[model samples]
Target: MSFLVMDDGEYSFIWETLCDLQLIFHPKYSREGKIDHKELLGLNIKKVSVMLDRNLLSSLLKLTRDGYLKDEQEMRIIALLMTWMIMNNYPASAGLALKEYATKINDLIEPKRELREFNNIFDYYPSMMWLRLAEGAIDSIPVCPLPTEPFITEIKYNEDDDHLLMHIAEMLHVVYLCRRRELSPVEKMLDFLIWNYKYLLICESTLVYTAMLFTSQSGIKAPKNSGSNDIGKILVGCRNQAWDLNYLSNWSSFHYYEKTMDEIFMFATNDILLKRIFINTYTSGGVGALIEAVFSKSDSQKIFEVVNFNQRNRIKPDFGADPKIYLHQLIEQEKHRVMETISDRGNFNYH
Candidate 1:
């Protein structure tokens, strides 16, 4: 089936419709934002089409119509917009527009995939894309041998190549939260601490032990049948070597970590599936709450002490000396002291 190029009017209508729908469904504007639907419908589209990316959009649509791209690829391209909506915390009102847009777009190429399948693709595509990209990153590392002269020349001369590389890096950054979500609760908390507190010399066993102690004191039931020793051993085996702090200290970094955490907390609290998992797993208000509860100021101080003490008195792991035991003892002593204080308060009479 031949598909004609979308006219300027058509392009403007699509662009304006998307923009209005996005505003209508955006978190800050959803309640108060209003659009004159009839007025918008009656407006001249040609005037507004001048600023839109007409060539790029038309090329993409043309590619789909001409069967240069597979059905799934076309769906994924459409789903990228929905993925953007999800990532930006857009409200559900915008999803209806997105789904309808997807349907209409698919119809242009004689839809082979069902609407339900489209919905499913949209729902999980971000996570799947993240997983695939992560795997690709891992596999593609230790960059294959290339014709170095041409590679250097291409990088030096091609502006488009720079743009492509920057785009890939941005994709990796955007999907980071999805990668973190794949981790277990303890691992997630550990990752959070390591990321936010780079000064802390964290190890897997220390984190696992801390989590266990935190769970014990917080009265939160730990995951059934998952022992600290086993988890710690598994994690420690996979741990990377310590970072070169000197280099990291010199580099300027963005404050995106907190924003990422906020997004995770929002998703955990708002999304039904994520909410269920968050509730069942952490039994806390949200990601930040869980991290704060698990790694309190006192806990942080104690961890530093234990870690530093262990570092000073380094013992080979093969020798039956486990630093986690020291951490466990410290937490138990603190718990005992707290209980004694509670008992003392209980016996005191109030005026």
Candidate 2:
């Protein structure tokens, strides 16, 4: 059997460039935007084809002649033409155009309503982490060449937190293009953590808190006089047990669970510190400790061993009430936990 391999980078470059060019020529080519079909038809196909592959150029010409180019279709063809120009060594103009597009994207960013409305440390901190990572990623995009001297000595957060979300979404839209053509196991794990920040930080924290709440409410006390290692095991056991219940199952969709399990297996196989971090987040130190450990560059050696246990034999809590009712109670307890922590701290705010 014969098989054909395709270059993802080249394919992405062609398609993205085509779309960019289309938008540049016909600003109204996007959906809900107006377009002049006759204007596109006037383009010199032969001259433009000099810079593009015959197949791509022919498709554009055919679409234009047939008046089938509308909405996103028109935008894509323009980007293709523009991409051909850039690949053919028109970097100067192409670079400028890209900058303009970046500016337009930046303009669309607004402060996220959730961020503004958050009244406690848990939501605020995790949301800030997401905003920071996203902004850092977007700023790292090589749309323009770097200067010899540092352009800015210190990083500053954008006033519009929503822009960070928008910019990150745009990058995710072309993640195949942004990612390295080849990735090692460590790199793959890093990408997974970065891309799925919400799952790792927010959702995982909620799961841990919920599990702890459920365990306490079920009268399942932590092992008395046990060491941190034992505490970690108990927490892990609680989490596994909670997941088996129908109520907590909603906290993680099948897709999320499968991907998380895959990563967990990978971590265990490679003896990655992430496994330690995952288990440590549920300890007495809580998610805040995990964040501190990460940011402070604390050694993972301090983390205790998290023993694996059979999920089948884990604690099965009987709430003696509707699963939905218990689920709501757990959620409210989790929220109260956050509020209590914030109340104890007093006057905490995002910097």
Candidate 3:
């Protein structure tokens, strides 16, 4: 049996579909769009650190300092810290540099332990009820015989890549929700967040600790024109960091750092898919409500079954005969479905 390599156009279509869904859901975001001010800022890195067990921070930092991370691993962990710093009072430049260093050190040495596999999702689990609900969503999607092409084929998707796979499934669900035309804006966001709550919380916690170290080493200041009077300086700094998408370095290592930072910041700030929900929650209700929602649980027996079936049966298919044609067809189907979703409303008013 032969395989078909996915082309640029295929990848572009998948990416664009994701982007279009995001914009359709969240129309207020732009590369230069402003973040609204909020009284309750993000988690306090230092305060959270002092309150938590010291061993947790020491163990992780030790592993990082020992150079145990893999490609994109450090970025994922450091992004949390960068967001923490931005939420606190860390200077945007300083946060950027810390993120860079975190990404650079993994190349220097091997680890005594394979830390990636050892990281437990349960350790970061939210409230018991919340866990059940998220697990339920996980169980809801129909598990097909693993298809070839477009999705994972020969290569087995593992825990590290589960987020990616789960996200694809989640996107399909979002499409399903849209087609039904029954979900409200906030409810849709809640569903998505709850389904991926573990990863989101881990990112948030990891970021808080990461930022704490940076703040301790090099104190951060607010950007110019961003003041107490401005009412949105912290958020503005985050937006500014997201906007500065260009690289400052010519070397490969540093360039990788810059590129990763740009991607993470852009996702954190402008990609309204998740961030907007978070921001809206924080601004209106407060962090406590946000935490509750992130950790809240509901029944998952149905979703769990769907997830279980897919995990066992789905087969990745080869679009080898006509990869581009298959992708175009996929795009058209989604377009038609989206139109059906908005038919009663008459039109999609995208700004």
Query: RMSD of candidate 1 to the true fold?
Result: 20.2
lDDT of each: 0.29, 0.29, 0.29
Q: Which stretches of model 2 miss by more than 4 angstroms?
A: 1-304, 307-313, 316-321, 342-351
lDDT of 2 by residue, 1-351 (tens): 112122566545554543333322211221111223344335433122121212233333333333234444433443344333333322211111122223334421221211122112112122222222222321211112212332221222222222222222222211221223365322332333333342112244332332332223233232221112232332233332322221112212322454334211001001112222234433446644543344323322222111012123334444445544544444344334333433444632221
Comparing 1 with 3 on TM-score, the higher-scoring candidate is 3
Residues 1-351 of candidate 3 have per-residue lDDT tens digits of 112233555434333433333321111222212321131123222221101111223323433343232333332333233223322333222222222222324321111122221122112222232212222322111211221223212322121122222222333333434344365433444444343342221123112211221222233222222222222332233223222211111111232354334221222222322333333322434333333343323323333344356447555544458555544444344334444444545644321
- The local lDDT score (0 to 100) that residue 310 gets in candidate 1 is 58
Could you estimate the TM-score for every candidate?
A: 0.20, 0.21, 0.24
Q: Lowest-scoring 10 consecutive residues by lDDT in candidate 1?
A: 240-249
Ranking by TM-score: 3, 2, 1
Clashes of 3: 27
Instruction: List, residue by residue over 30-116, the lDDT tens digit for candidate 1.
Output: 211232334433433311111111122332343333423344433333333333334333322221222223333533222222222
Q: Per-candidate RMSD vs. true structure?
A: 20.2, 23.2, 24.5
